[model samples]
Target: MKKIFSFNNIKTLLAVLLLCMGSAACKKLIEIPNPVDRLTPKDVFKDSAGAVLAIEGVYLNFGYYELSQGAIFNGVMTMQTGLLSDELLTSSADNTFVDFANNTLRSDNNAVASVWSSAYTNLYVVNACIEGINNSTGISEKNKQQFIGELKVVRAFYYFNLINVFGPVPLIKGTDFRVNATIPRTPVNEVYQQIVADLTEARQLLQPAYPTTGRERPNLHTATALLAKVYLYQQNWSGAETMAKEVLGAGIYNLETDLNNVFVAGSKEAIWQLSTIKSQLYQTVEANDVIPMFPFMIPKYYLSTHLLDAFESKDQRKTKWTAVSTMDIDGVLTDFYYPFKYKNNTAAATPREDYMVFRLGEQYLILAEALARQGKLGEAQPYLTEVRVRSGLDEITPATQPAFLNAIMKERRTELFCEWSNRWFDLKRNGTVNEVIGAIKPEWQSTDALYPIPLGERRLNTFLEQNPGYTE
Candidate 1:
């Protein structure tokens, strides 16, 4: 693991203290100052309010430029992985994107580096928060549990992304820079076991109700939803089914009938969302990143033909979630389609959208897949039908187990695209990366399932090792 404080110049210990303190008062967390005033972790977590602010500060880290909003981890990885799969196509000549689209990624790819660095950097904040909350003198036991619960989920979430992207990764649980700097990669299964342990504890510690009105903070259901996903990735069918059913049975969320309403701020479907900071120009990073100015105005990415063809003619998602543009190609008129999931491109007086992290619709799919994988097709049909019915499509009834599994996979691909590298990870976890993605991307190798560890990180940490098929 890389030393947390030294990883980014903007994230000094003093700056981190101020950033945590500033989260409660500032309207925008990222715009906080970098003052030189020094304070230990104890100083910041001395009060209940400061502890709350420190936890909120971790949410700000999630929305940072390199992580989710700025198209490095969530935004860029979503598009690039879609391109790597069959859901997206490169719309520009940018080599950074084309490499992902083409499955020719190298160890030096900046996006891969950003994903690695940002994840670990944010994980450091979460670990520190966990330590502070546990050792606080003035904070109540109830408050400590709530804050620590949220921090554990955040920590597990980063590890979830790390292990999925890079295979085995160092599982750093403490905030000790000296210990973490020299840690070696843990086995992928061991890392997942830690994730499961963290989330299970988090589920117990969290309240049923969301901490804040915005659903920006993780609650019991949020932890449950993430745990369901972790179980699904591990192919723990019964566990995944039970967890998904738990979230569904809670009755706190509903599937959005209107697909267009799902991504907007305060949607009932959103289980956990990232609250956006108001800006003079862009409403949210996703809106500015995805919505194109015109049909052929060189958007960062566009929907792939394969993805466009996956939808049925009457599927409302195709019309509601995507847009078409016209361009003149030589003598004939050509049209291109782009993801229109986020429609607000410019900033408004208030935020038009918040980034959706977890939602109710995905739970249904998880339940469907879990049941289908366990050979319980009869029990799975209704859950799969629920998602399809909401999307204005006919209910599917796959007779055979293999057919039902395929249906669930297809539903996941269409429903969850462009959200948190879902398609990429799905193809990987299903062991079809070489079969499905390789057919589309000729250069794709079995070893390409996991991305190369960032070269700089490998050099800095002697214990770190590169993934297969990459050179240091």
Candidate 2:
């Protein structure tokens, strides 16, 4: 098998790609030999294998890499956003973690800038792939459509996170840095519209079956699954219900009976998972960072009191997904609980877990919430109960629509905690950020509902405006 292509200098390559934009006029964009070290857009999309390899690079970015500031998809969202919300508490006094936890984020926060840059960096690659695949004549027609569809799903996912985290952001559709740098922040609603459009198109072009051997790539249902989430976030209750119900009933996945199995690589519940590139050190960055070598050792990141107290009694997630560390504190044993969702810290010959991006569990919650919001309490109860029962909790009895919605949200807090900033995004989307975060954090402010646009980015692009409540 041919090795996956590597971007020797992504910046320089992107600059070259900018001049080689795919168009009728630019048809014979300078051709170079197919060397794996260097890949031009023309060389990349010249054939089906090259097209597939180009997108694989995008997936590689999401897995464990040696970058000092980790890529956004590679557990960055879970850690930073986890701190920004109440899901996690860190022992380290890093200012980046401190700002997020205290809700006093400055424009120059290194963490914030890393996230911004990482996301756009990946987005550029995705955009380039889309352009290359579309412009390619060597690749088969079907492959081109599916590849573009997959890229759109990824692009939508990035923009969705950007919209949620930064309120408004530049929606870069192409690989031209000059144009992207000068683009102003698009409104949140407009960004959502674009996300909806991308997912909508993606759903049409993708096939139902996994494009690859594993669930590493997005399928037709994957696009639908994400569209469901997009609808849920937009409060399109009916649309959310339709999309979630389709995935839930498509017979593709199930809720893992053992909560511990839910996050394992290629688990039955995973709709989309990010495959890890095995290395000598660890299978996943999240596991290596969050899990201590010894059971009795305190972890770098542990559950916050707010999150620890949220789980109800007999909740298996509290037992199965979390672990306790008993440390000797001056002859006194102190216990600290931390997330144990990803169990493989050491690199095994075969990985036990892949970074879970989407799964059947979230779909059930989405379906239940969508139904409950539409006053279909009777219909929604079963979906919510399925998840609860799987976790060894008693099934909830029927309740009013509002009560059902509340229960669904509460269940989301416990079931999805520390996974992907679910708690933080939920707090913001549900308008409970100030109430929940403010009760715990005295530094919380209404303006903190959206993070500041990174200061360095704003300085570079004067067109980019600062989010309210941040200094220019």
Q: What's the C-alpha lDDT at position 368 in model 1?
A: 92
Clashing pairs in 1: 71-76
Q: What is the lDDT of residue 416 in candidate 1?
A: 86
Model 2 RMSD vs true structure:
5.5
Task: Name the weakest run of 10 consecutive residues (lDDT summed) in model 1.
Answer: 64-73
Q: Give the CA lDDT, 0 to 100, for residue 328 in model 1.
A: 78
Candidate 1 RMSD to the real structure? 3.1
Per-residue lDDT of model 2, residues 1-472, tens digit only: 0011123223434433343344222323334444534555676678987676566667655544333453667787788888888888877788878788788999988778877877777777787788878888999988987998999999999898888888899887876665666788898899999999999999989999988888988999999999999999999999999999999889979888988788878799999987664445777788888888788777878889888888888999999999888989899998899998888887773547777889899999999999889898889989999999998899986557777888999999998998777899999899998898889889888998787888888777888888889985
How much does candidate 2 score in TM-score?
0.91
Q: Give candidate 2 misplaced runs (Cα > 4 Å).
A: 1-40, 64-70, 349-351
